[model samples]
Each structure stands twice: as structure tokens, then as C-alpha cells.
Target: MASSSFHAPTLVSILVLLLGNSRAQLTPDFYEDSCPDLLNIVQAQVEIAVQNEKRMGASLLRLFFHDCFVNGCDGSILLDDTPTLIGEKNAAPNANSVRGFEVIDVIKAAVEEACPGVVSCADILAITAKDSVVQLGGPDWEVKLGRRDAMTASQAAANSSIPPPTSNLDQLISKYAAQGLSAQDMVALSGAHTIGQARCTTFRNHIYQETNIDSFFANTRKPNCPGTPGQGDNNLAPLDIQTPTLFDNSYFVNLVAMKGLLHSDQELFNGGSTDAIVQNYSQNPDAFIQDFITAMIKMGDINPLTGSDGEIRTNCRLVN
Candidate 1:
């Protein structure tokens, strides 16, 4: 792979020639200053783009799932540090299996056409997710700005950070906690799985052996998720029953129904300590959204580099 090499003087020279700011690094403050309406614009633009794709909701839903599950949506999992083709593919394209980067690429193109280099992909994802929640009729979340991009994506981190569909409540909590999120945040963030789709392979164990899921629902799903090994592609799981495109609390409703597509989801209500909260949210969307917003806010703040920990990235795929 080929990369552009940079030295402080050369970068400064170019910046001085272009924007006349030789001393200032590409900063998150730049986005806030140059594009005051960036978040709203990103939100609207993401909605429009997803509407056109017919898969935006699924994509955004997956992005958030992977983001929170992996490195707490810090954009670290998306970095392609070594630039290896396999690394990029595994870390970038396959992280969430929801095709987030593809949507992001489209959004990036649109943003470039509209605002040039003023917006970062990481920020685009943050704002886009907030709007996606609103699009799905969930609570409105306050997303802070100034998230920098990573130059190198971490495939190792991606593997370790993302949550498998079969993870138990305890495993899920531990992973999210590493990102600075709490158990409640994990439960709420997991609510996002309410609006997407999963392969049968992801939750095969739950159906075939887990004692938690309702036998009736498990039997219903068995024909679709047959035990044949490597037949994972044959099975399908929908995240939301009513409006998969809209982010809401129906996932919890499905959990109570024993219709959760993933074992991890079913585990919450099957026989876990959080079952009551899951049932409560399943029964009340309003309360779910209120808590979901709170959880998302917490998830977004996990391990964030501020006050000198991380640099403000000009490009999301690379570190500044």
C-alpha cells in the first residue's frame, strides 16, 4: 500500500499556502467554527442518503452497534494503520457487518460536495446516528462535537471490541465497561439491535441449546436457523418488527416476545437480572427512549480523547 508522507514543515507550508494557518493543527474546533450547522446538516443529509439507499437504517443501526461494542464508538476500530488490504477489509468493512463505511463514504462524498473538507467522517457518524434515532422516533440525544479521525484502523481492536450476537449480558457489560460505559449503558445501547438484521449463524447457539429462550419462539426460528454447520447465511434475523428503519424500543418488545433475533438480546429477558428493565422498556417506548438517550450519551463519551489525550483528526481514517 502507498501512503503520503508528511513532515511538520511541509504540512505547515501547505496549510500556510492554503488557509494561512501554519501553526494550528487540523482541529475539531475547525468543524464547529466553519460549519455551525454541521450536526443538523449531517443528520438531514444522512437521512436523505439512507432513504435513497434503502439500507441506511440497517447500516446506521449496525454502525452504532459496532461503535459501542467496539472501543465505545471512538472511531478507533475504523482505523487502518498498516493499510493492509485484509486489515482494512476486516476492520473497516466487516466490523459491524452492517456496511457502515459504505454509507459513510456516500455521506463523505455528499458532504465534500456541499461543504468540502469541513466535516469529519467520525462526526458525520455521530450526528447521523443521533438523527437516525430521531428518524426511528427515539429520544433526541445531545451529541458533542470535536471527535478526531484515526489514520490507522485497528483490526485487532475491532475483533476484541465488537460484541458477538451470542454474547451474554455479563460479557456485554464487561466489553462496554472497557469503553467507559456502565451496565445500564450496555443494556440501553444494546437496544439498537432492535432495528437491524442478523444472520442465523450469529444466534445459532441460542436456538439450538440455550435454555433461556421460549421454546415456542426457538422452535419457530429453528426451521430458518437449521443446525447445519456453515449454513449461517440461510438464517435471517430482523432487528425491529414494526419499523426497522426507525430506532425505537420495539426491540425490547421483541425480547419479551421471545422473538429477539440474537441470543444476546434474548438473554436480557430470558433469565437475567436486567430482565425487568428489558420488560419495562418493551412495555413502554417512552421510558426506553429516555434511558436510551442517557445511555447513548454515556457511550459516546467513552475513552474519548480530550484535553490532550488525542489529536483532532482532519481525516477520520487516519490519525492527525
Candidate 2:
């Protein structure tokens, strides 16, 4: 009689575990009941930030990409270093490159005021990125929510996982493929450069040494990004000179003209496997917008810690 009771309870427990895992899938209305005004709060804050500085829209979008790529959109990139935890902030690709943390803090404060501890920072990032796209004239898509904040951060993973600005075509394809993204997705996502700017140091080698770039474009950027070390390293240059502040197909157009600011940016159009996709995007704005929206949605689905796996962080910069 004792053994029978134990076996029955164990079977029930197994079933519960399976059901719990199945219910961890993300949905657009995940916070509908808990935080009815969640989307409004995020959109209002993001609009104000982007209105103050047009680049803030691009910064927020980049922040989402950095967070998602490093550790599956679990909000690990936002964590600050502690005695036991090394955060992704100081990673090579992100040390001085990533921005918009202050904007996220502002949005989180508004969310906490309304919903207290109900919303997760991961969801905040996903929504803010979507809002940023809309503010910058890009296509809007429903961002699936329910991701939890990571208790730990990985600087090593951030360094290795995130592709560098100097990546070649093959490297870029393989890097995105490792994250389950296709080459077409990579080309579409690269269109995000339409609004952001890169530091001189990031494109110095590309402008100075790469023969794939247009001579005129390379020479124009060289004065600000000198070949000599420590010279104009922090200078800023728009990634897409034609429409630097607008989210458009100009980035692909520039790539076709060999005017891409970074080596990685040019790699998509450099007679490689991604060349056809880049050509298609350059000639068709609607196609680029559709693929970009689909790619962003796919990227957001990367290895999230859902259900009870992680905690809802009260502060975006610190784990609760």
C-alpha cells in the first residue's frame, strides 16, 4: 500500500513537470493581465528618448541585439559586475560600443511605478526595441514576451558570440548560423545599420586597407579614422550616410555601391552568398522591411529563460 501511493505521486509529479515546460512558450499578451499598460508605458518612454535624440532609437535597437545574441535575450547584457559575477558590459565588442542603458532604466522606472515587480527587464528590452523601430520608421511587429532576467552575466560568451564589425562574409554567416539564424536573416538584420553610427576605430581597418570599398567613400572616412594608432579613435561616423537617421533600405543601397561603413556591413554585398539577398533588399524596400521584421522576431526567440527558470528583476542593472 505504501509503495503504490509513492508511485502514484511520482507519476503525477512527472506529468506536472512536462506541463510546466510546455507552458513556458512566449506570447504577445503574456503581461496583458498583470500589466495592462505595459506596452503603452514602454512606447511613451521610448518615444520621448528617441525624440530627444534620433540616435537613441538605433541605440536601443542595438542594445536588444547585444542582449539577445549574448545569452538568448534573458537580459544578461544589462547586468552590472559584482564580486562573483562578471557582466557583459565590459566585453570587447560592447565595452564602449553599446549604449541606451539609461533609456532602459527610465522605461523600467515607469513600468515599476505602474506594475511594481510584475514585468521582467527582458520583456522591457524586447518591447523597447520594437518601439524604437517604429519611432525610426521601421516595420513594427508583435514582440513576444515572458522572458525572465538572468541572475548572472557572461563576458566571455559576449566576446565570442557577438560578431565583430570586421567580420567577413563567411564569418558573419557562420556566426549567425550558430545562433540558428540563416544567411538571409543575417542580411536582413544587417539592414539595421540604416540608422546607427559606428566609432572610427570600428571601421578604421576597413577604410584604410580593404579594396572592396569605394575609393571615394574610403578616402572621405579616412581623415576621421586615421591609420595611425590612437588617432581619432572615438570619432563618430554615420553607418548609412544617405539616411543616417532613418530606418530604410539605404543601407543595402550603400552596400551595393561599396559604401558600407564597416567591413561586416560590406560583406553582405561583396559577391558572396549574401550578395543576392543584399541586392534584393537594395532594390525592394518592402521586401527588406518584411524580412527584417521576420528576422527580428526570430532573433528574439533565441534561448530565453522562461517560466520559473529566472526571476523578474526589480532593477535592470542588478539581479533581484
The number of the candidate with the highest TM-score is 2
Against the unseen true structure, what C-alpha lDDT does each candidate score? 0.65, 0.93
Would you estimate the TM-scores of all the predictions? 0.78, 0.95
Question: Per-residue alpha-carbon lDDT of model 1 for 25-70, expressed as tens digits?
Answer: 2333546667776665667766776667645666675565565455
Mind giving the per-residue lDDT tens digits that candidate 2 earns over 17-106?
Answer: 998877678899999999999999999999999999999999999999999998799999999999889999999999988999999999
Off by over 4 Å in 1: 1-32, 53-55, 68-72, 79-96, 232-235, 306-320
Worst 10 residues of 2 by lDDT: 17-26
Clashing pairs in 2: none
Give stretches of model 2 more than 4 Å off.
1-14
